[model samples]
Target: MNEELAELAASGATALVSAMGTDLWQEAKGLMIRVLGRARGSRHNELTVALDRASTAARGAVDARAVDYWTEALSRLLDRDPDLAQDVMALASLRIPERPGNVVQLISATDSAEAFAVQYGSQHFASGPKSRERGERP
Candidate 1:
C-alpha cells in the first residue's frame, strides 16, 4: 500500500462523511459508486443501503466513528484499485474545497551527541541535522 494513497483515502473519507448530511449527499454517493466501478445489481443495492444507513447515522454531525469507518473502507478500495484515487479526490474536493498547499519537514537529534535521524517522507539529511539547520543540503 502506498502511504500517499492511504493519506488520500483518509482525506477523502473525511470529506465524504462530512458531506453525508448535506444536499450534496446523493452526489457524493454517486461519485463513490463510480469509483467502485462494479457497483451493479446486488453490489449496488448493498452500497446504497450502507450509504443510506451511514447518512442516517451521521445526520448532519461530523461523527468521528463514521469518519474512521469510511477511512478504512476507502483505504481498502484504493488498495485494490489505486487508479480510482483521482475520482475519489474529485468527490472530496467538491465537498471540502481545500486550498492547494502542502508542507514538508525533517528533523534529526539524539542524546549523548549520538548520530541519529528522525524523518518522514522524502528528505535528505546530512551526518547531523545541525548542518541542515544552517541551510546545508545533504
Candidate 2:
C-alpha cells in the first residue's frame, strides 16, 4: 500500500480497537460496516464478527496482532476505493469520553527551559510505574 493509505490503515486500526468499549464503538463500527457493506455483501457478516473479536481483544489490551490484521484489512479496503479513504481519518479522530472533573495537566520546567508539552491518552501509553518501562517521560 502507499504511504497515505498505509498510515490511514494503521491509525484507523488503532482507533477502531480503542473505541471498543466506549460509547462510540457502535458509531465507529457502523462507519466501517457502511463502507464495507457497500462493496462486499458476502463479507458483511464475516467482517462484523471479525470486528467484534477485534473489539474484545482490544478491551483486554491493545493486541498488536489484531491491530495488524485490521490494518491490512482497512488498507486493502481503502486501496480498492481511494475516494473513501478520507473517512478513515475521521475514524481515527474519534474522541474518547472524559469523566467530568478538573483535569489539571501540569508540566513543570526549570528556568530557560525550551518548549515542552504535556499529553495523555497517547497510543500505546502506559500509566503508573509501568510508564517508565514503556519509555514515557514524566
Candidate 3:
C-alpha cells in the first residue's frame, strides 16, 4: 500500500471518531487498525479491497451521520485525485446508507488537498459541539 493511502485511511478513521460517535468511531478505528496491520504484509490492491470491505461494513452498521462523514471525506479525496474517483465510487457503493438519499456521487472530480481541508474543517465545526457536550473529545 502506498504510504499516502495508508495515511489517508488512518486519518479517515480518526475523522470518523468525531463525525460519528464514540461507539461507531471505535468500530471505524478497529477497521483502520486492521487495514494498517494487513497493509504491512499486503499489496496495494489487497489493501484497497480490504478497506473497501471495511468501509462497507462500517457504513452498514452505523447511522447516516457516519456515512455522511465517510462520503464527504471520500468525495474530497476523489476531488483531489481524479484518478482515485473509481476507488471512491467503489467504496461508496459498499456503504449502506442509513438514509436512502445519503449516498455521495463523484463525477469527473479533481483532487485538491486544500478543498479536503476546508470540507473536513467545516465538518469538524458542525459536529464538534455534540461531541464536546457528550464528553467524547477523541
Looking at candidate 1, what is the lDDT of residue 137? 38
Candidate with more favorable, higher lDDT: 2 or 3 = 2
The digit string of per-residue lDDT tens for model 2 on 13-131 reads: 88777677778888988877766665454555777789767555536445688778878788877777776676787787777675445577777664434344545554443543221
lDDT of each: 0.70, 0.71, 0.42
Candidate 3 per-residue lDDT over residues 68-94, each given as its tens digit: 555444444434444553343332233
Using TM-score as the measure, which candidate wins? 2
- Enumerate clash totals for all models, in the order shown: 0, 0, 5
For residues 1-138, write the lDDT of model 1, one tens digit per residue: 899888988888888887776777778877877876642333446656677687567375578987887787777777777777898888778754333355565555544233554343354656543433443334
Write out the backbone clash pairs for model 1: none
Sort all candidates by lDDT, best to worst: 2, 1, 3
Each candidate's TM vs. the true structure?
A: 0.58, 0.60, 0.26
Candidate 1 at 98: error in angstroms? 11
Report the poorest 10 consecutive residues by lDDT, candidate 1: 128-137
* Candidate 2 ranges beyond 4 A from true positions: 41-45, 54-58, 97-138
**Model 3 residue 137 CA deviation in Å:** 67
